[model samples]
Target: MNTYQTLLVSTLFSSALLFSATSHAIELPQLQQRWAEIKYQQTGKQQESAYQALLTEASAARAEHANDANYLIWEGIIRSTYAGAVGGLSALSEVKAARKLFEQAIELDANALDGSAYTSLGSLYYQVPGWPVGFGSDKKAREYLLKGLAVNPNGIDANYFYGDFLLQQKDYQAAIAAFEKALAAPDRPGREQADLGRRQEIMQALSLAQQKAK
Candidate 1:
């Protein structure tokens, strides 16, 4: 794989910090629950295969709940993660599909799943290649991530990703602040494993940002 694909694939499977939501409000709670398990519980080839299966399941869920922002966002999340898992030229198509799904979710409801669409899109914009290659754009990433924060300023995923973007931009202090906020975000009631994993990621980001600041 090329540089963009390599980085994109490795970083794609970062699960979202999901919170308990009203049953009717969430179109696919089962998918969300299964997703957290597959992302944080599974490992290596097993994890990758699970993600691949989950992507298919997510696609079916989307077909059933067409136009539902929740389903759209979840499916997009799965697509992105699966792309990261597979990591090849073929994965490129999956990410592209994921990007469109996120955009569609935003158009339907920017606040669905705690503004996850914006956050996912921001992550994708930064991960994908820019022009002449893919559609990655640091500028767009910052804009979308900030929009995600505007919708859910204290959201764990939003802050963590924003911090990641800042770190990439060499703003170590700002990245630290963002990671600190992410660490302070609330835990998911039914998603303890995902919370644990995300906390580990936040802590690692914190350590790196602190080191870079010194």
Candidate 2:
């Protein structure tokens, strides 16, 4: 082919590549918006419906970007949330599936989505029952949460979950500090609803921490 024709073809290919990347990146905000809305649902039945919808979308996104760590992390997050909404002994299996997704995401890119896998995995470790029943471990929870904090010190999830772990450990003073840090976290753009919800949770935790500290 002539030089001009070759250059035209190269430019078109580059544009196509850019378009593909942009399309994939756009899914993140879409997922976040859906998640925020799902979390806002009041009744358990409503939450269950919302979670199912979000999970369907998340699963599709994950399939589209099978190798994308961000998509994998989000899938895990959505799965974990859905499991919580399901609420019962059976939900443990769903959480375990979520853990596998999170672990796979970490393996692909530990820092993707601001080290979200670490934050979530840490939460699972503490939220699940310990001993003969489940794999929960306070020590592992703290360690993973600290790792997430190392990467995203100002992240709302990192601080809030860490504070929760501390609260569970009865270190009320430290819990207060972490909760305060979470409250001070900058609002995540395009995630206003999520931020609002998270801040409310932080305030509740802070209130309890304060009472315990006193």
Q: Estimate each model's TM-score.
A: 0.84, 0.86
Q: Give the candidate number with the greatest TM-score.
A: 2
Best by lDDT: 2
Candidate models: Cα lDDT each: 0.87, 0.89
Q: Candidate 1 residues 1-214, lDDT tens each?
A: 9999987776664322132221224238678788888877787899888888877777877887887898999899988988877776778898899999999999999999889999999999998878877888999999999999999999899999999999999999999999999999998777677788889999999999999999
lDDT of 2 by residue, 160-190 (tens): 9999999999999999999999999998888
What's the distance in Å from true for residue 186, model 2?
1.2
Between which residue pairs do clashes occur in model 1?
A: 129-136
Off by over 4 Å in 1: 1-27
